[model samples]
Target: MTTTRPVLYLFGSAAPPVFDVAAVVADAQGRGFEVCLGLTSTAARWLEPRKAGLERLTGHPVRSAYKMPGEPDVWPKADVIAVAPATFNTVNAWALGITREFVVGVVAEGIGKGIPMVAMPCVNAAYAQHRQFERSIADLRGMGVRVLYGDGGFVPNLPGRGKPEEYPWHLLLGAVEEIRGAQGEGRSS
Candidate 1:
């Protein structure tokens, strides 16, 4: 059966904050989104113990790999996509169009499909200092992604001193709501 609720494809990478995805999913649901959880391969393994519970929460199977050709899609089509706690590798790979990971592949393709997408990176201060990180952020912005980084979004913490608990998941959820609203306006106009 199809759902009337706006569907959100919430993707997470292998970062410390990813462990808190259950709460994030609940929060997204509270905000009226029908969320589908997707993870990078490593993040899937990291949360393997909680996989079944996550499925129960979202009412959909958690996906980490592309389905075999001809396999039917289990989740509803996404109205918006949000990548929270995106890792250093995920950011670079997405900006470079590398689709080895399912999460990156969807977001990369989402650009061409005109799906509103947002991403917030979770990286240590040292990794943030890498020149490529800044360029990737810029590239993603150029491609129309609302990357929640720096100032108002995720600010990297010092290596070995990171606080995953402080990651601003609310910002991503708020952005999704805002994007959905804008899409509605555009459709009416």
Candidate 2:
């Protein structure tokens, strides 16, 4: 509400889809979001080659770490977040509110800030079956973080074999819109 365009925090994990972030950024912008990118440490390297291009697309530094205590924040406050290809590790850590990494820190804090958020997990079926993964999904859903997983959302691939065609990157932007619209209309997200 403070700005004409929503400030979107587009967070990427270490999934193979992280390499295709340029398309995601373009899509979010097309949907009227002013995107900012944040990568999990593992994802930071995967995107290093595209960092400058990403910065140019987003008009903000692609941050992968916490700034020094005295350093000023560079990114604008987020209106919503879309974490496509969220990994199993980040999902569970975020559910536990662990701030071990920069992406986790921002997302954990986003939950507290009551910002609308949507996440699309990119885990294999074996990883998705873990008891903790189920619990984490429930916990996040309870806190109103939309987890785009299972059934109509993301379907798990075979262990050690994720096909790029099946990552479901296109679903995330729509999920964000649905959740944000629901929230905007005072409906449950």
Candidate 3:
């Protein structure tokens, strides 16, 4: 469906940085995106107290569960998706096509729809050391999702030493803009 502004599906997992989602949503909206917020069930519970405020901020419902079958979609069709503060479990579940969670399910289906997508993992150094973590990152990248981890993206912190205030939320927003710009170029060419 056509929208006045690009629709961005912003999904979050149960990471410490997920608590900072209010600012992230505002940042996305400021970047010319109609933001729709989705979260892992755990993250939803973590932010329960702020759910109403988030709905007001995004002008849409905060979703953490699949809509009932045949229910009308409440949000605009996504032009792009950004999954930030992706936890180790979320990254693996998505890469393995395990869509038990609402956020993972949308992003998994988004891949087949050819929607531009980006992900930034919030794993610690210990989780990053796991073999599955590296494989999952590669798998998501192979499926055309731009993963913001290592180098210029999110760097894993030592366990128990994470600075949630320092999560690279801006980088995720920047990638969304870059993806939108690239899509615009492709359409014009």
List TM-score per model, in order: 0.98, 0.93, 0.98
For candidate 1, which ten residues in a row score worst on lDDT?
163-172
Q: What lDDT tens digits, residue by residue, belong to model 3 across residues 88-173?
A: 99999999999999999999999999999999999999999999999999999999999999998999999999999999998999
Candidate 1 lDDT (Cα, 0 to 1): 0.95
**lDDT values for all models:** 0.95, 0.88, 0.96
How many clashing residue pairs appear in each of the predictions shown? 0, 0, 0
- How accurate locally is residue 97 in candidate 1, as Cα lDDT from 0 to 100? 100
Alpha carbon deviation, residue 48, candidate 3 (Å): 0.5
Model 2, 31-142: lDDT tens per residue? 8889899999989988898899999998899999999999987877887898878999999999999898899898889888899899989999899889999999999999
Comparing 2 and 3 by lDDT, which wins?
3
Clashing pairs in 3: none
Model 2 has an lDDT value of 0.88
* Stretches of candidate 3 exceeding 4 Å from the true structure: none
**Which residue pairs collide in model 1, if any?**
none
